[model samples]
Target: MFYMSTASGIIFLLILFRMDLGKYCDSTSRTAKAFANPLRVKDFWVLMTLPRFWAFGLFMTGVCGIYAVYDQQFPVYFSSFYPNPEDGIRAYGYLNSSQVFVEALCMLFAPWLVSRIGAKNGLILTGTIMFVRILGSGVAVDVWVIASCKMLHALEVPILLVSAFKYIAGNFDSRLSSTIYLVGFQAAQSLTAMFLAPVAGYGYDHIGFSSVYVLMAGVVGVCLLISCLTLRSESSRTPCSTVPDHAPSPPATTAVV
Candidate 1:
């Protein structure tokens, strides 16, 4: 919820720097006129053909689940920086070591990961890391160690994002694809997230943080296995890697509300 506000604010500021909100609508009209019979949803409904994309999402979700557990332990991490327990909130602001490096990696090499490894194999590798990392984080209760574990978000967010864009752009029509691919997924994710978040948070507070972490990992593992079965078992080797570069990422404007 906080990051949602932050992202919206940043985009609004970016819009102000370039053009007014009215112009944004006008630009959309122009863009619509520019292409005909573009990417459509009917083209690609079955997602498994695109390699372990579902597995990749599972892996990412596992990594994301960690923060839910970690946040519940904030007082502990906060205590380290501020000797005064009440000043934990202030210490949160001063911690800079992990964030700087993580952001740098996301900005610098995310493209290279997609361009170099290709989304298929790259996601599998990352997903594997996701499974391993979650299990490890739960096993170790060290606060600093958990903080260091956050470096995975850099990988988790962008890797899943770029791969999703790559797959949708290649498989769907450009026009309707915007609504179906971008808006549709965002909507579904937003709805599910609202419900899942509370369970994770409540689980952390009551049942135990480690239990929540393991459940999150279990969710991811199930998805990963399903994706593997669907993609790997298909003997039909009709190459689906057809989209080229210059594929604009659904305007990068669609976010689940």
Candidate 2:
């Protein structure tokens, strides 16, 4: 089933590519370049010097760790609530479907929300929602209650993930946008998983599922505080052109005898 789904996705992307519908409408490409070179390395170091960059990286790490724990443990937590295992599984399925539906709706309105509130404020909103959702999950008694929290989870994805991308692109030079994003989103999340996965497993073993959620809630709450304190409003952001130029000119080649 997974392979079939993957194949379907590949085919759909191919169709889009064939029709040239994959092009970005904006002149600026938001796509990240995967290959590393001297220029990207220099840009990355320049980005690292900013305090806001560290704040954003830490925020991404904490949120991704919380998500990893919730994704792994929620099934066990859900199954424990019902006497019949199948009933618990069915309930979990319903919650997943509802969350996906909510996420779809959130995506439809995400652009408008970003336009109104801006990326920094959007992160604040989503970070708060994520904190609330994780806290609610820790104490939720009914499946429907958890389902409602899952809807909030959908709203967080666009605000945290999409807005973070926009924040990097808009505030920094276009040359550095992709590198900064890759570091903040992908590398930070990967590092969080590597360290936190074992800790979360130990937590589930010793303290049970609810404790894990509570712990995650606290972590996300801290991240929210950091984001609120460090993230600047859109109006106050430095224009990309005014950002310090860090891209290095290519080294001159020497002709060897």
Candidate 3:
């Protein structure tokens, strides 16, 4: 851990000195203007009223909620495959480490994948894979089957991390990117886990892990159906206009970035 932190610090120092950000007027001024008046209460209310916000928020809620449940419960589920508790822990450690390694590798391809499919389709693809992976884990009788399903995390998480932010930026006001990400995505995810985690715990107590997981997957299925029906379709790398019809246009003096 100490060596890793030291190495990371050295890399950060190198980037700080080596990277040229250009003049303050060219870079910082534009960026500062881009974020100006980003979070007025009126704008936040308007944001909340948008259907796209709810649709994407629902998507985040479903995917992130199940992921939270899986994080808490998967070890217990996998442990049952081994009679010895220590053996189960060791096995789980290897499986989880492989998932992290695979996720890192997949992250490199995420940008390319999202660009080809567009953000909405990228989300749908990942959600579909998530449904199958979670369901497979629930239905599998053998440890190998479960392990294979769990490995699907490498596909789902990396794509989700990339495409979700893109979806937000494309469908909403660029100036409000921070507000949308914080209020729409992050807050929704936190709330979903807060409310759903206890329910999942209850399900585990009453119905066991497999049954609970299947039910969670069902929830994801419902969210995916909603997304498919309501989420806007767009071309690869398209820049969507964020101004709504009901809202007045920005003044002529307002700089377009």
Output the number of the lDDT-best candidate.
3
* Model 1, span 1-257: residue lDDT tens: 69998999999999879875565445446354434224444334444343444433343344333334444554454354456766755544444445555766786777778767655555555555566556555665665665555555556667656655654444443443455444434644554466677777677678765676667677666656654544322234344332222335474566788
Q: Which lDDT tens digits does candidate 2 get at residues 150-197?
A: 677778786666788777767766666666778887888877888888
- Which 10 consecutive residues of model 2 have the lowest summed lDDT? 29-38
Sort order, TM-score high to low: 3, 2, 1
Off by over 4 Å in 2: 1-4, 19-40, 241-257
What's the lDDT for residue 163 in model 2?
80
> Which segments of candidate 1 are over 4 A away from where they belong?
1-34, 38-97, 231-257
What is each predicted model's overall lDDT from 0 to 1?
Answer: 0.53, 0.74, 0.79
Q: Which residue pairs come into collision in candidate 1?
A: 38-173, 38-174, 39-172, 39-173, 39-174, 40-172, 40-173
**What TM-score does model 3 achieve against the real structure?**
0.83
Error of 3 at 4 (Å): 3.5
Please give, for residues 199-235, the per-residue lDDT of candidate 3 as tens digits. 8898889998889888888888988898887777774
Model 2, CA-based lDDT: 0.74
Any runs in candidate 3 off by more than 4 Å, and if so which?
A: 1-39, 235-257
